[model samples]
Target: MPAHDPQATPADELSQARRLLNRVFGYDDFRHHQGEIISTLLAGGDALVLMPTGGGKSLCYQLPALLREGVGVVVSPLIALMQDQVDALRQLGLRAAFLNSTLDAETVHATEQALLRGELDLLYVAPERLLGERMLSLLERARIALFAIDEAHCVSQWGHDFRREYQQLSVLHQRFPAVPRIALTATADQRTRQEIIDQLQLQEAAVFVNSFDRPNIRYTISDAPNPRERLWRFLEQEHPRDAGIVYCLSRKKVESVAEWLTARGREALPYHAGLSDGLRRHHQQRFLREEGLIVVATIAFGMGIDKPDVRFVAHLNLPKSLEAYYQETGRAGRDGLPADAWLAYGLQDVITLRQMTQDTDATEDFKRSAHQKLEAMLGLCELTSCRRQALLAYFGETLEAPCGNCDNCLQPPQTWDATEAARKALSCVYRSGQRFGVNYVIELLTGKDDERIRRNGHHRLSTFGIGRELNAVEWRVLFRQLLAQGYLDTDLEGHGTLRLTARARLLLRGEIELHLRRLRRPERGARERRGRTVLALGEAEQALFEALRSRRRALAEAQGVPPYIIFHDSTLAEMAQRRPTSLGEMAGIPGIGETKLNRFGKAFIEVIREHPG
Candidate 1:
């Protein structure tokens, strides 16, 4: 650990931070608000940081802990990820250890003794264990530097990933009044942000709210009827042989998708709460240590995962809220590379989610909040305007113009006036008793004179054949839009029966206009487009990049750590392009810190030298 000077000026502290930043983390300068956040902690002040996932939130506390007097204690919610966190820090040559259930009694004792003797620079602890009496007493006896509360939004009851243990974290403030506390999270709306501040008792902390927009992620929402096929097309086109996550709404769907993808020749795994702990841990370890593997999971996975090179995140069903969506999608592109956030949803998703929300045994207010969040997510999917703009605005941020990277911006959708169509659809739902699901409703509208339709109703009804101007697919799209726009609602206890909301009266009376996005089939050759290139490497550089990656994989396997912990893909790309010949030149690269330059620099340099460029 670097020694801190008590008499150092603020500028001097900052300069030392910058030097350590290069020597330890291998970055040239501080990104966005990192320097200010670090300076606050160095001056013994509390902080509340809300930055995006890849926005370097860990550095804000980790760097300060290295420069401070004693060990920095990090309170994390995910116990499974603590080992990786400690391993990454240790790879940087920092004295870091974690105390969790995975550690045996002897290991725990050694780690605790290390803290007491002031021999550790940083220590990671789960919130549940940190709040225990033994750990609290142990901390009181040690010289503590600061406390970092990660995934701080979990403290909010209204947040998407709320953990009951987080609310108890306020004890940190009461116990260690002088130790500067920093609470950090990747996703937090205005409501969640306030709750975190309130629950964690960080009212006097310096709040640093960075922009919530992840511009590198291209958002795409498809309502195509064949979602599985669409997902395959997406994978085949954009992320072939890339590591990603596929989110489903149920454990059954998670397992099926994993099996289906595996049959289709992709290495996919299933992860959910239903699975045993040992199985979950095995899948997670394989995902971290291997390459191009996909994990099909529910919301149970991916809270504090530090894998940096995930290429995409796909959702087969609608998430409960935009907060959940943002957090899940932010998992991609953690290395500042281009990634995709894809969704394939339909009216069924809306119905299933609404029913799930209503079926929950929570208070009415909670149910209403969940419904509003679901509505917002639906609006995003049915939106004909810029998706990024509306998504940002939901989180209280504004994008001045359309982000050209999103589906809507790239290929603008055409809208048609569906006023009369909506009126006819609603009338069919009413005239047919409103006791049927979407398929039944659509069948009646498209003039399907099947036995069920004939037995239930007469073919002589006015709405029976009135919607012939639109095909079955078009009618499905219109019905989905109607439900999403609140002109129609589904029965809570029924089998997805359609019901008219009070807002539908005006449309029925022709008092207002209704315009909806025109449904169009995806282009046949769309999959031919190349995926986003992380670096503009020439042919020779590309070959050299592969060689460096092979070397990284070998080293990572030998040391039993993830390859990115050794050096991220971006770093290898830089090394391939620069072709550094000596230690000094290697140190000049972006991700080559002093520790790494001395540790693996020679091996990589030899690879660069021996490559046939």
Candidate 2:
């Protein structure tokens, strides 16, 4: 086994890639743009891949690695991720092993020995360990196939998860210039993708950009009187007794929400960086293994989980970027099941996310990047168009129309001309020495001359009583929209005092137009429980599902593992969707077992022809 050897001919490599694709991954087809990436890698070229989260990225590298007749050294970022991927690959009868800090020295030595003996198909290593001199030497001694960087966005300084260790991965190209390299990321905007190419020195690398759209997850945003009550209502209505994640912006909030869900008799757990390592691992493991469990956490969870049945993703606060939101929500519906992406947001979420970014010690360029992303997220939150369209547009993609599944597309929001409202608000900020907070300015404009208002002499201003037409809540909403639209700025040092930006000045002088979306109450009709549609199944799958259902009913009659345990309605529906043409495909369905398949697979296939599509 050596690092450098004569490369295979292009025709041979292409035939090898195609053969491995059908033999290993069990796919008779290649997704859009997959063949081009495969050809680039097989031709001994580097590539940067920007695909959506569930866009089958693993196969792009897995096929190339398996075809090259040597070990593929994959640089993974997390121990848990490496372990999970290795376990799945081994289950598929491919030889895969991982070396990380979690293993003892003896295990590490044994794994290195296996690599040198050319006994493994793919080996996962963390960037921290892979960049070491000893590790490089060991790799040099082995038959190197291809070097793959998973989650390559971490190398970019502008990405959410910037790791200093990832910067060291550039040495791979310098050390093995002949070996093909592929950097794959699920979530990277234009800037981050460019940074990855520049930082990884993939100057000659080909780039593949896929469409950033997930049409299955329905997006919904709500303004609640009390967010907890709304969250409970949402959980009860849409995703009861199903696995989901609730994301908050703080650890305390995570704990509080988890406890609150528990008090409400939900099987909920909390995870955060503040928790002990043992407890975090325990909770995470349980959440993965069990059903009907909810894990409330900050953004510290759901990186490399491959669970196929997550039903929903709820956000108690706004995420900082559309990319972050897209990646987080993608955790749901990985199995292509219909799921919900719900959010309960207010002005405070925007303020908190912005303050967090502003206080970080990153460079000014990083800060500006963060701000632009935040603004994009805010735009998504407040947009009057289809939420799905707005989200896809941010990623330089387009949609035909409103998805008709989101809150906005279901119930059109009302809009009001706020030109006069904006003028009054901006005039009040200017008259109050640009130092008063929104609350005080609203009070003065609505003609409440309280002690502070009189002390500040805001009552004497001409704009003081001009805004009496709007109520307190309406006024607050106006200012929130103003803040989000960049017409106003909050002085961070003075308790977020309202100050006018250039946009506000333009509005004050009637040089700019202003329109605001009035928050619409969730329609009572929208709350109705829509019945789930079972897929159109062929004769065999339908019979199989019915037989499985009959067995499930019998089991529920006996020891009682619930009909869902035998097979969820979703699993039955998917049995109809895929029409599993073979026994292996049947096993790939979520809850089907060999016993079940052996007993009922033929019957299901027979009934599949009669099943509705």
Candidate 3:
């Protein structure tokens, strides 16, 4: 078999890839851009793919690696992700292995020997390991199919998850000039895309940009007070018994939130850079293997987690940039089911993020870029229109109509002309000597007779009692909106004191009319659990699904792998609904490839046969 099939027509090559897909992965059709990407690589051409999470980006390279003569080298970032991918491929009975720090010397040498003998269909390596001289030498002795750079956006300085090691991956191109290279990521704006191309030296690679819209995800952002309670309400209402991730901006918050949730009768774990590596791994493993587990974490937790049933991703604080927000939120609903991206941010989140960005030791240009990204994120949170439209537009995609899925679309927020309110708010900030935080300023505005106000002489100010019409909650909402809209800025040096911006000058001078979202009380009544029933199975089917899950869990525990490695929930749902009692019938299911049919088909068939319904 030739490493490069130069004479095969595009039609023939695609036909072969499709056959391999069905036989190995048990999928009948190609998703959005998988076929085009696979064909690009199969024809000995480089590709730069930008497909959304769960859009079948893996198949683009995985299928081609199997069809080609030599092993496909995949550059991955996370050890857990590589392990999961390899385990999944092995479950399908494919020749897959990973070389990472987790493996001992004996296993690493055996994996290298297998590669030299052309025994691996796919090999996943970290960028740091792949750039090493020893690994480069080993690859030179083996037949090469192609190179895949997963999470390719990490090479860009502008991206949220930038890794300096990824920038050195151009060495793959420099060394293996003949072997095709494919760089792929789920999130990257136009600037990051160009940077990836330049840094990875893939300017000539075919660029395939799929739609960044994850319609299954319903985005909701709230500035409600008592965010801990808001998060509890959200979890109780929607994801009471589902696996999810809750993100915090600080490691301390991660630990505290996890402890709080655990005390509240929910099993939550903490994950951050501060935790010991063993503990982090243990928490991550528990989150993956168990159902209805929530992992409260900082940005360190999720980057290439392959768990498919994450029903929600909640953020208790503001993320640094829109790219980070989009990337983090994209982790939910990777299985293409209805999921949620919920956020509970406050004025203090804004102040803290601004201070952190300013205090960073990065270059001024990078700081400016970070500020711009932060502003975009604030804009998305403050959007009264379709959030999906604005989010897609940030990635240079267009949604002509409202999605009707996001919170803004489902429960349209009413906007009020706040020209007078804005002028009074700005005046209050200025009249307070620009030295007090939101609480003090709001107290002064609402005519609260406090000793601190008297000592500060704010009681005699003209703006002290002007905001008496609105209550404290309403005023806080207005002030948060003011900060989000850039009409008010936080004094980092003054302990988050509110100060007016140039933008606020126009509003106070009567040059512009300001309209803001009216602060509505959090919805009252019995909350309905929406989008939780992913399978939507009948009672009998639900019982059978549980039985199937039990069997999968047993098998996974025996093998020391996550249950999804054996079979995803969707695959089991199909089995439960179809109740395929025979091995032949089970093979007709979507995820049961030839290898899996031969491996575990009879066990699942026995379960289906024993099911009462």
Candidate 4:
């Protein structure tokens, strides 16, 4: 552990932090608000930090834990995340340990003893564990640096991923008022942010608001006529053999997707709340340690996962809210590299979500707020402008200029005059008695005469067969846009029936011009084009990169750790290109700090020296 000098100048503290940043985390500088957040906490002040997942949220707390005298108590929420973090910190030669439900009795006792002995620099525990009498008693005896509340959004009941244990975290301030506290999360909108400040009792904390934009993740939303096929197409085109997550809305769907991908020769696993604890841990561990393993899961899966090189995040169904969507997508491109965020949605997504929200047992106000978030997500999917701009705006940040990395920016969709189409669709809903769902109404318009349609004697209606110009898929897009744009609403009491609102009158009477993006289903066997690739190197350097990766895989397998824990792919790519021949030069490269230089530096240098490329 590095010693902190009480007589040290402020310059010395800053220099020490930079030295640790390079020596431990393998970075030369702090990213975004990390430096300021760390300094504020180290100065015995409280802080609320809103950084993106890949934006170095952990470093802000971890660096301070090293700079200050005592162990930084990080109140994490998940077991897998705690293990991933502790493993990474240990690899960096830091004294890090964790206490959670997964640990056995002996191990827990040993870890507690270490905390009291002041042998550990950083200690991670779940909120429930931290609030326990035993753990609190142990912490009380130790000289504490600060309390880092990771995933602080879990404290907000309004968030999609709220946890009851997180609300109890305020007791840390009540018990240890002199110790500084830092609450951190990667996902929180304006309201949820305020809710976190309130719930965590951090009213005096300085707020560090990092822009929520993940510039490396390219966003794409497709109409799902056949989501299974669409997902395959996305994989074959955008991310073949890449490590990613395929998000589903249900546990059953998660299982099926995992099975389907595994059968197709892809490394895949399923994770959800319905699975056994052992199975969940196994799948989660495999995802962290194994490269190119896809974890098909519901929202139950991610929130504190520290795997840095996840190449993509695909959504087979719409998430519950925009906040959820943002957090999930932010999981990709965490290595400061290019990645993809893909989704396939149709009319069913909107209806199913609306129905699910209506059926929820939460308060009416909570349901309404959740519905608004869903609407915001729908707007992002149907948006014609910059997706990044709208995504940031939801979190109370604005983009002065458009980002050119999203699908809309790359291949802009064509807008069509849907005024006549909107009138026909609205009239069909009215003439069909405004009681049927989207599919039933769409059938009458597209002229698919089902038994129910014929039984209701709706074939003779004037609105029937008027929507021949648009297919069922296209019509679904229109209706979904209408619902999203306030022209229609779902009657929750009537079992997901579609109803026209007063706003629908404008489109019905030609008072407003309706224009919608004409969605195009990709041609069969057509590949989706990707944006710029990450860590681009020459062909000769590519060979060296592969060799470095092969060696990294072997080292990781032997150590029972993730490959990125040794060194991220970005660092390897830099080594491949620069081809440093000596230890002195290797030490100067980014990500190769003194600890790593002493440990694996010689072996990597040997690889580079022998490679003929």
**Total colliding residue pairs, candidate 2:** 19
lDDT of 3: 0.89
Taken over the whole model, the C-alpha lDDT of each candidate is 0.91, 0.78, 0.89, 0.86
Q: Write the per-residue lDDT of candidate 2 for residues 509-569, one digit (tens) a residue.
A: 7787988899666445335432122234555656665655565456434632233434455
How well does each candidate superpose onto the true structure, as a TM-score? 0.98, 0.87, 0.97, 0.97
Per-residue lDDT tens digits of candidate 4, residues 318-364? 98888899889888989888898998887778878877778878899
Model 4 regions lying over 4 Å from their true place: 448-451, 523-533
> How well does candidate 3 match the true structure in TM-score terms?
0.97
Which scores better on TM-score, 1 or 3? 1
Root mean square deviation (Cα) for candidate 3: 1.6
Query: In model 2, where do residues sit more than 4 Å from their true spots?
Result: 1-19, 455-460, 525-613
- Best candidate per lDDT, number? 1
How does candidate 4 fare on TM-score? 0.97
Q: What is residue 475's positional error in candidate 4, in angstroms? A: 2.1
Q: Which of candidates 2 and 4 reaches a greater TM-score?
A: 4
Estimate candidate 2's alpha-carbon lDDT, on a 0 to 1 scale: 0.78
Residue 527: error of model 3 in Å?
A: 2.5
Deviation from native of the Cα of residue 309 in model 2, angstroms: 2.2
What lDDT is reached at residue 526 by model 2? 39
